[model samples]
Target: MVDTNRITGAAKDIGGKIQGAVGDLTGSKHDSVEGRLREAGGQAENLYGQAKDTVRHAADEAYHYAEDFYEQGGHSLRRGTREVSRQVAEYPLASLVVAGLVGFGLGLLVNASRD
Candidate 1:
């Protein structure tokens, strides 16, 4: 996952430095300016690549964290369901009473909403 832009930018920066040095030795302002411009462009490209890499890494981390959280949530739900089932089986009459109460409460809520 080496970024091409980063590599290209580094090469351009090196070339620009050499060009600038030659321009200085030959007393050519045009060459010097061109070299400076190239150097700046290379720096911008390198920064862009670095930013892209940072964002991608952050997104990958967030995705993995969310995936782990979801898996844990699922496991917790399954365990809770199993516990409830076992409790209901161990106390059938109590479970029936609780179910009746819940139904009655839901019916009350529905009637209140209608009113």
Candidate 2:
């Protein structure tokens, strides 16, 4: 979450540049190799950061979609309940029986799906 790779990459890049400069000044092969390795590490870290950013964006989009679906479902339930209640007012007994049967069937289906 903190994007440590990105931070490390930046640090490595700067460190490599400094080390490479020093190696050049002192004519040291070992220092040159170390510097190149550091630079490679930094580039890898930068790539990782980009990948993390892409994943974060995708997760955010998925969360928004789920939230939208939940909100819409709640609204649909409320509207359906209101309409059903209005219909029930016109015929109490038949509506009650039908509603009970529908609820039982729905419950059974839900339970079956969970299994």
Model 2 lDDT, residue 24, Cα: 79
Q: Candidate 2: list runs displaced more than 4 Å.
A: 91-115
When summed lDDT is taken over every stretch of 10 residues in candidate 2, the lowest stretch is 1-10
Give the count of colliding residue pairs in each prediction: 0, 0
Residue-wise C-alpha lDDT for candidate 1, range 55-100, written one tens digit per residue: 8889999999999999999999999999999999999999999999
Best by lDDT: 2
How displaced is residue 25 in candidate 1, in Å? 1.7
Prediction RMSDs, each to the true structure: 1.3, 5.2
